[model samples]
Target chain A: MADPRAEILRQAAQLFAQKGYVESSLNELAAAMNYSKGAIYNYFSSKQEIYDAIIIFTLTGLYETAAKAVSEADPPVERLRQFMMAHARFLADNYDCFVTMLVGFSGMANSGLKDDALALRDAHEGLLRRILQAGVADGSFREVSAAMTGRAVLSLLSWMVRWFKPGGGKSAEEVAQEYHDLLVRGLLA
Target chain B: MADPRAEILRQAAQLFAQKGYVESSLNELAAAMNYSKGAIYNYFSSKQEIYDAIIIFTLTGLYETAAKAVSEADPPVERLRQFMMAHARFLADNYDCFVTMLVGFSGMANSGLKDDALALRDAHEGLLRRILQAGVADGSFREVSAAMTGRAVLSLLSWMVRWFKPGGGKSAEEVAQEYHDLLVRGLLA
Candidate 1:
């Protein structure tokens, strides 16, 4: 069996994603898990702690996945394309986690986790900006502002969480390929 | 003085934007507006009604703005560029309403307004998709999946609400122009 702690986090993420974090209750989460409230407390001190753990875990996973996607020796454009595909794939695979993070980041205030979440986001954007800068420096891409372009592309990719339905339409791979074609060709010098 | 109803909505939008709709309360909204709960009830029946009104108002405002932005008889590519800039400017100008709508749409479920909200979003996306299709048909843009490209462009523009700070760095015009250049150039044949 999976660790009970892991199960708690997983269930909490689902609840948070389905309902906004503020709307989700520890009692409801415990009910969903078929655990007593006391049992839940044995694992997590509070709802905020569960939320923080989920944010930290998901952001770390996302960053590591994106970083590895671009670490290969491919050219800048290819590296960037791979990075985006990896990102879309990760989001599709962990749809609940992505939704939870999106809701949490947008709605959370006066929480210690906000700074960590923002820092993680900045670092993620930083990774994409570096690739854009590399593409420009290598004369493979046009002279666009890396910061703006990076944000635009990341925005295009991240918004998938709002609309992407796993089985309803195009597969994640196809969507990624289409995005790569549309964006990379636009950037080619 | 502004209409008391409009005043209530404006204050509610600010609170909703700052705090998630689920986290915000009618009593807090009334308190913020310096109105008693009874006075607020005269304008809105409940918290959800205020949210629905804001969603309807903002979405209607957004759709009207985008529709007007592209109604001129420019070439399809020019129309598309104009459409994007108009969308970005609207978001920048009505930043709080945009944020409120975003949080409201994402977190709203089992609410009476969900279908209305979804219909409005589809209509908004429909406007952009039509422009993309026109550009493709006229050969002003490369062959591309119009639906996918439209979502991508909309995502890029909509996500701006998350990070755009009015006086922090780039002006709204600059951001709009940058997005136009990056996306339009990508779409050109």
Candidate 2:
């Protein structure tokens, strides 16, 4: 079995994604995981804590994998392509957490949770910015503010979580590959 | 003055956008407009009808505008460009209704509301399909299924409601233009 703490966060993220954070109660989360209230409390102090943990965990893994992909690839365009593939794979693999986080999981909006979430998101953006800056320096990327382009790229990749259905015509790999093409080659034809 | 009926729907959409459908109550909707409960009922039968009407009114206008935009443009790419421009403008112009209809208002899952809402969405997709089909026929858009491409395009454009802030570094026009360039021109250097 998966680690209990990870399992608890997974179930909480799934429930939170289905219902808004406020609407999802500790009771429902426990029920979904077949855990008693005490079992849940043993792992998490409160719901907000669970949300913060998921956000930090998700963002850290995403940025770390992206950085690793960039380091492993030689050319900047290939790195960019790999970055899109990695990001898309992360979302596709963790659809519930990805959708809940990107599409405004209410729990994360709690006043206490916001700062930590944003800080991690800022770190993720820094990773993407570094990749883009490197691409520009190497004559692979077009001239655009790393900040604006970062937001646009992140927004595009994150937006897929909300719409890309699993069993539809294209697999995640195919969609990511197409987007990767769009990113590296652009649409200019 | 705006028709009281239209005014009620408008205010409801705004509130629904701000606070979600379940969270925004009829009493608050009426109170927000300083109208008595009876006054709101005088315009619509119930909160649900108002919800239905709001979507119908918004989607109808949007579909009409999109159809018209695509019809008047010259080339296939230009037509797609026009559709994106109009779609983005509508979303930006009426951010509240856009959000309420798209993400925040969530009554549709198994409710009777789903069919009507789905139909409204399909109508808009039909418009996109025609434009994309024309583009493919004219050798402009890369050969992509109208159905899937339409989904991807809507997913891309719909995210603007969540991220774009007025008076931000990029105006809606600039952002729309950039997206248009991205969608049509491809991202290759």
Count of clashing residue pairs in every prediction: 0, 10
What is the per-residue lDDT of model 2 for residues A1-189, given as tens digits with 9 covering 90 to 100? 469999998988899788866578999998887889899898889888887788777887887777777664577667667777788877777777886675454446555767776777787788778777887777767665677666667767877876677668677767777766655554333
Off by over 4 Å in 2: A167-169, B111-113, B144-148, B167-169
Question: By summed lDDT, which 10 consecutive residues of candidate 2 chain B come out lowest?
Answer: B103-112
Q: Ten residues in a row with the worst lDDT in model 1 chain B?
A: B180-189
DockQ, per model, reads 0.47, 0.46
Q: Candidate 1's residue-wise lDDT over B57-96, tens digit each? A: 8887888888988865787777777788788877887788
Q: What C-alpha RMSD does candidate 1 show over the true interface residues after superposing them?
A: 4.4
User: Candidate 1, which segments miss by more than 4 Å at Cα?
Assistant: A106-115, A187-189, B106-108, B111-113, B187-189
For model 1, what is the alpha-carbon lDDT of residue A4? 92
Question: What tens digits encode model 2's per-residue C-alpha lDDT throughout B30-121?
Answer: 89999999988887888778887877777877787777777544876777778888887777777777777766445455446667777777
Residue B71 of model 1: what lDDT?
67
Indicate which candidate wins on TM-score.
1
